[model samples]
Target: MMKKRTILRFFILATLLLCSSSAWAQGHSYLKTAAGKSLQAELEFHRDPHQTFAVRGDNLVLAGDLPVNVNYDFDYSVLEGQTLTVDGEQQHGGRNLVSIVTSPGEVRVESGTMTINKVTKEGEKAFLEGTYELTLEEGKTLSGEFKLHTQFRDYNLSSLGWVFMLASIAGVWLLAIFCYKKLLFDAE
Candidate 1:
């Protein structure tokens, strides 16, 4: 009995460790500032989980508010399998435009490259993993890595459609109740 109990405890501990590690790998970012300060935080989709990420035009936007507020946008890029080099200009063209906001302040990626290392796609969901090394103003450098998940569509219903569906369900329930009452009266 004691041996069985020990094995059970070992399995429980192993399960907990596996679950925690997977949860931690979901989405995370490690950013270094110009002044040598480092900020590490989780990048989560704050809006609805259904709307994990978005691709507006040629821009890939990941906005979240957690341990730190971050708005990481890679302009002129969509999906994975590409490396975007920052030309130091903020103009939206073939050049990759990007921005990183940390706790200290906003740091513009002046010169460097952000490489999307891997992209895992399962159905409509996609996981993006990448690393970036950029030069900030005054010869300061910043580099980090990021892994995030995004969905293709939210799949939300419109207000009018919801109203129509609810009305139809209510009408059917009312009809059923009325028919039951009429049947009882006829039996009487």
Candidate 2:
């Protein structure tokens, strides 16, 4: 009877530990860049899970994959004296290229073109397309992009989920051990 009680106690503790650990081990975000043409570029702001910013001559492209709504703003000093264009429309801004787009879309500028697209279950990528012509200037230009992506899964338990799991398992285990000891060992 005593042996049975001890085994029940061990079972309860192990169950609680397992539940807590498994719950805490979920959900993470990361960034990834792919194989592509190298262009002179700088990142002024990064506000998403994965992002890329590139500049070719007078054209610029910014892309990313994200799980939530994020806003990023950037300035380009490289396009000092060039005219800006997007989707074939001329932009009057002194800086060559300025653009904004949601993820899985496109932002085309005089310096280049940028396309944001979904990459995987948990990732995304951006692409550059079109031509660029550079002039001369000093003050610089600004461009930005925004994205929102949300994913949900059942097994992807959050911190609260783990806590609940642990509490339930511990409670069950304690009750089982108490019952076994009272009815079997203490009764004997």
Winning candidate number (lDDT): 1
TM-score, every prediction: 0.39, 0.22
lDDT tens per residue, model 1, 1-188: 99999999999999999998765644233333345554443323333322222211111222211222222232212435665554454323222235444344655445666566776655655566777676776677766665555544444676988999999999999999999989987566
The candidate 1 region of ten consecutive residues with least summed lDDT is: 50-59
Per candidate, the number of residue pairs that clash is 0, 7
RMSD of 1: 10.9
TM-score of 1: 0.39
